[model samples]
Target: MTRTLVDPHSVPAELRPYLQELVHRTHSVCGPHLVSVIAVGSVALGDYRHGRSDTDVTVVVDGALPGRALPGLATALAHPALPCPAAGLELVVYDEDFAARPSGAAGYLLDLNSGPSLPGKVSLDPAQSSAFWYVIDRSVAHQAGRVLYGSPAREVIAEPARADVLAALRASVREHSTGAGHLADNRVLNGCRSVQFCRTGRWQAKRRAAQAVAASEERFRPLVNAALRSYERPSRTAAAALPTADVRAFLAWVAERVDETAV
Candidate 1:
């Protein structure tokens, strides 16, 4: 079954006009080559917080956009005249072939992150890399994505393999836990969600995932609560309130559990 488009009214008032403009501009730039533009992540999930959240979009094109199109799209998106309304906009461009066919590979034509602060920034050089995360993203888009243009998301995006999804989650947890400093709120909350998904094959938002972890595991309650607070009201003080050592210990424990389950 196809998912319904996100109710425009549900979008943040400040962000709605900008999002509409973005879709219009994207269509103008891509022309007929553009397959669809999908709104994903928090905005699509109805959990967006004006200043804290980001506007995530997936642009599916017919094929690799010509080299010249890149700069134009970047310039258009980052024009000082049209200011971004959130922390930033994270947009990933993928080819229809890639979306229709799930390859356990990593590569994207354009991965653009731009906003008023960082105008016209593009990360396309490393076109080839392990894109395990894209698999999970595709799954998200297929299930919950909001289509701004073109057909239903399921028509253009394929379901990711369960193993690939697990691999991506494992990689994310490892990356987050490798450092020694206090973990970011997203890192802590996402780590919990990843563990939960690995164990139960159910995906949930970060806060809900933290609640689930707290409900099931008494040992993780304190750290999870700290993360939840940080997620709710993101601030350096809230983040610093977390017990760094305990957070690391919890992450390590989660890593071990994920590893055990994988085995």
Candidate 2:
């Protein structure tokens, strides 16, 4: 049986107009170079919350955009004139050639995270560069991503190798596990999702993954519950409520399990 895909309109009503405008502005900026614009992550999974989730987008271009075009696109996306409703906009721009055959190395043309904190500011961080993010995003996009422009996501994105996905998850967990705030939440939840993927060969949103893990392993229930609670009601106090030591132990345990199954 053919599976039904999540509708792009499943994104929160308050955020839909902003996403539409983002696509229109991107099309205008990239012009003929534009290949596709896709929405991935929670939004694509139909698990997005208006104030907590981010609008994760991947813009595919025909070729590497000119240096001048990079700043122009950034300015256009984070311009004070175009406001976003969610926590922020996490967007990455990729070249079609590279996306079609990713090298498993850091080579994304542009990585942007913009929000209301700095309405007119668009900070570009090379430190945020990771082939893992691209690879994982590609896999998610292929499976459940919503196409906002150009071709269907499956037509434009290649399926990431299982080994590659595991590697990316490992790297992600390691990198984000060091912090106590939002990173802690990300590490715990994403680690659970990674463990779920390793066991089931299926990707799930963090909340669902946490629920699955809790259901399967009684010992992990408390940690998963904490993460889910924090995810649902994100705040400084909620983040602080998480048991840091338990989160660390969970990460280590999940990482070991993932490594044991690595091909």
Candidate 3:
């Protein structure tokens, strides 16, 4: 049976109209081939911090999207054409085959990373060389994503294997562990979430997972709480840095622990 697409009522009120246009524009591009559009990441997870979380989504098509439709679709949803209200908008489009049975390669028909401040990016490859993250995203979407259009998410998004997810989690820490632009709070909170996911096999909001880490691992409470505060209400200006050494140590510890887990 062919499923109908609708703007999800459960999303944040501000996003309702924006998403309506998103779905409408997407359908116009893909025509009847559009399958589903699943909302994922912080916005879908209910931990969306205004000015922090990006409006992330996955668009699925029955078959491959026509190459000619790419430019128009990308241009329409990107920055100036369709301004994003959140920190930015991150959207990926995949055909039904890959959406139903994902791989670690991170192939996509279209990948858009548009933000208000950050430069816009349109990619067809794993531009950052982190294909595994897309695989992990599919897992998160399958488990916790909300349906914004077309079929129910689970009906299209197949969960990636546990081993693949854990592997990706381990790889993910490297970028955040030590980099010029890596934020202190983001590193700490991300580390906590990685640890929590390893132990529970669940996808949790960064703050919730940080709280759990603090409650159980008292050693990291101070760091976790600090990060939580920053994440909940991010500052417009710079704040005191969380010790880089400490954040790196925690992430390394998380990677080791994740590697040890039975996937």
RMSD of each: 3.6, 4.2, 2.2
Model with the higher lDDT, candidate 1 or 3: 3
TM-scores of the candidates in the order shown:
0.86, 0.88, 0.92
- Note the Cα lDDT for every prediction shown: 0.72, 0.75, 0.79
lDDT string for model 1 (92-189, tens) is 88888988876555556777777643344577753454475566677778777878777668899877777677777777677777654334676788
Count backbone clashes in candidate 3.
0
TM-score of 3: 0.92
User: What is the number of residue pairs that collide in model 1?
Assistant: 1
Clashes of each: 1, 0, 0
Q: Judged by lDDT against the true structure, how good is candidate 3?
A: 0.79
Best first by TM-score, ranked: 3, 2, 1
Q: Which segments of candidate 3 are over 4 A away from where they belong?
A: 1-7, 234-240
What's the lDDT of the predicted structure labeled candidate 1? Answer: 0.72
lDDT tens string, model 2, 9-70? 65667777788788878877888788888899888777786667777898888875665687
Q: Which ten residues in a row have the lowest lDDT in candidate 2?
A: 1-10
